[model samples]
Target: MRTFCVTGFGKKLKKHNDLLKIESKEDDNDEAKNLLVSPLDFDAVIVSGEHDITTGAIRLLLKNEIDLMILDHFGNPAGYILPCGKSKLIERHETQSRISSSKALCIAKAMCIASMINKISLLRSIQKNTGVDIETHIERIRKMTVQAESCLEINSLQGFECFSTNEYYSALMKIIPAEFNFTGRNRNPPMDPFNSLLGYGYGILYSKIRSAIVKAGLSPYYGVFHASYKNQEALVYDLIEEFRQPIVDRVVLTLIARKQVSSDDFNVTNEGCFFKNNFKKKYAGIILTRLEQEYTYENEKKTFSEIIEAQADILASAILETGKYSPFIYR
Candidate 1:
């Protein structure tokens, strides 16, 4: 299964037998026609708001249990379409009941500690390749991880996370080239090209994790570490912490180090730096490839996408008190 991203205006999607066909109504049709034959060809379809999808296509997608993600003009997630008739009511009820329980705290702390470990591990990997001395930074984050594990309250856990990440990013910026001008982390229109790539990659990752959580019969709104916010997928936010460094951060850093992304790839507006359309597609492709890459986990090789779903399943088991939750740690 794969993911198909649809963009542009006047695009129509239809189901032809077992195949999915896309046709463009624009006059200048350079990249208009597309066909998705087998149901196994794609598991997800990401459609931009500019495109028009037929009802038949939607029905077919739902029948095939293919996840659908809709993005707004600015490349932010607007909505999602998940399959119906699949329910794990007991798992969900347990999740709601355990919100304030000690189990919740354990899961939250585990996620934070896993995140810290992955960040430190990524830094070490970079240092090994580039010969950059990041031992001080790694040791500091290691101490922070220990604090996170001992934290009984969510507030203190978040505090340790913030401090650890601040130090980690500070060292990370020094390792990268100065031309990217990534002083610090900033979102809601990232301040620099590096931050822009980071934000974009994280958004893509959020959508993937959101789908996985829903498929695992958990609520995306209810969370352990991150509190629910209006219009926010809080649980997705919580689960995504452990993955941010190993997935998106690593991809963006590789792109920058290899000089694959240039200043011309971004457009500087009054808001901040944004990736141009072509560059955005290129970046998204890289992220998707990274997510599909196979890695060894628990003595078995699994794609990063599978790891995400497995993590959600583990969380559900933990919520149900049937098993313990362990966050995915990159090796």
Candidate 2:
């Protein structure tokens, strides 16, 4: 199963029998001719920018039980199309019942710990190559993790989590090259190119994790760590914490450090920085490829996509009291 991402203006998607055809109205003739016409092999289709999609394609996607994620102009996930009436009620009941329990707190703390560890690992990897002294920052993050684990309430845990995350970003800024000019993590309208890429990558990751949660027969809105809000995928947010640094942050930092991307790839205005349409497509492709790379986990090699699904299932099992939940800590 693969993910198909459609970007650019005047893109049209249609379903013809078992085949899905994507036609780009752009002037590039070769690009339109190279579009993939095999929809049966796709697990999901992510559509970005202005495009027209046929009802037949939607029907085919639903028939195949494939997810369709739609992203806004700024790369924020706007909505999703998923097959209805497929979730099991018992699983949702278990999920709700466990939300306010000690099990929930434990899972939240574990996520925070894993996030801190991954951030430290990333810093250490950077230090090794750049020969920068990050030991002080690493120890600070470790202390914050210990403090996070001791919290009995969700509010306190969130506070410590934010503190640790801020500290991690501050330390990260020191090690990265001065060209990226990454002062701190900003999201509202990501002020710089680095934050812009991070936000866009995170949105893509959120869509992937949300799909995994739904496939595991769990509700994405009802979460233990993050409170349910209108149209919010809180469970996805909770589960995505441990992966944010390892996946999105690492990818963005690598791109900046290697000078793979430039300021010309983005449009900077008084509002904030935004990736150009073509550059956004290229960036999305990189993240998708990263998600598919194989890695060793729990004595077994698995792709990040498979690991995400496994983690979702583990969370479901924890809710059902069939097993305990453990966050995926990057080694």
Candidate 3:
């Protein structure tokens, strides 16, 4: 979908001008504030700047049908939101396909519980007739898959005992490249630390959303490589992971590399760490521009949203009739 990112580091904005573009219908000076529309407007806004959200801002965001994100100091979203009608907004979103509801639920429940390894197993199970090369991105998937299992183990048996979320996140921090920056600060951005945290969040969210799509009777896992996750929709993660590299992590890098933001843009509060007032708009701009650009993969050029939608279709067909889910494993 269209993801509009609006961040508020130190201040929140009340009005959004994204939807209203000025048009000139009459003579040169007879310009009225008419509206111009883009077929691909932003779908949601990711706000990571403050602890307590402003009600007026929430209302504005909801009216625009935008998704708002609130993250802690380290940039992790706190588990609370202001029910700004986003449920309804996201709910009626035209799903990518038409699959049966019961099949979707079963696939979603299964995917939520299965680890990356378990998923690989499921992929392997479905690989025979699909011709997907499980080995294509095996190295990266292997590392993250192992860690996901470890996280579950740590959460379950240890009762979150051995490591705090911060500690876990801290370890994740180790993966981003040392040059990775958030808004203004040069935070460590290694692959595992960076990708894993993002992957974890995306994995959870995909299951939540895919289940809805599946219930709408769409495919969950007809991916190119991981063709087997058909009923469960786990294959979407296979595609989304490709995006995390260019989307989130790259934006962080662009800001740091360009010296546009620094550590001063963040703040630590009781709720957790969040963006300071200074850098929200700047960070949001990065994501916006990035989304507008064409991304090249597998010798074809496409927008970020288009690529993901293709993956959704792949999943839809897989669930509906044992179709193959195409994985986006770039060289």
Q: Indicate which candidate wins on lDDT.
A: 2
In model 1, residue pairs whose N, Cα or C atoms come closer than 3 Å (at least 3 residues apart or on different chains), thus clashing, are none
Candidate 3 global CA lDDT score: 0.41
Give candidate 1 misplaced runs (Cα > 4 Å).
Answer: 7-10, 24-32, 73-75, 86-91, 228-231
With candidate 3 superimposed using the best TM-score fit, by how many Å does residue 320's alpha carbon deviate from the native?
2.3
Stretches of candidate 3 off by over 4 Å are: 9-239, 257-260, 269-271, 297-299
For model 1, what is the error of residue 148's alpha carbon versus the real structure, in angstroms, after optimal superposition?
A: 1.6
The residue-by-residue lDDT of candidate 1 on 1-331, one tens digit each, is 2677775456788887877788766573535455455656778888753777788888898898898888754456788877774423334555564565587788889999999999999999899989999889999999998777778788898899889999899889778787778889987767788888888778778888888888777788778888635567778989999999989999988887788987788887787887776677667788888989999988898999999989988987776556888899987
Give per-model TM-scores: 0.90, 0.93, 0.45
lDDT per residue (tens digit) for residues 1-331 in model 3: 5554333333334433433233332432322334344314654445443423456556655666555555443444444332344343333224433444444433432332233333334334334424545443334444553444334222231222222222322432332345433122223221222232343234234433343333334433443223344564444443443444445544553454466655455554444344443354455455556555776755789775565566555555556566644444423
Candidate 2 Cα RMSD (Å):
2.0
Weakest lDDT window of 10 consecutive positions for candidate 3: 157-166
Candidate no. 1 TM-score: 0.90
How do these models rank on lDDT, best leading?
Answer: 2, 1, 3
The total number of steric clashes, by the backbone 3 Å criterion, in model 3 comes to 40
Pairs with backbone N, CA or C atoms under 3 Å apart (clashes), candidate 2: none
Of candidates 3 and 1, the better by TM-score: 1
Count of backbone clashes, every candidate in sequence: 0, 0, 40
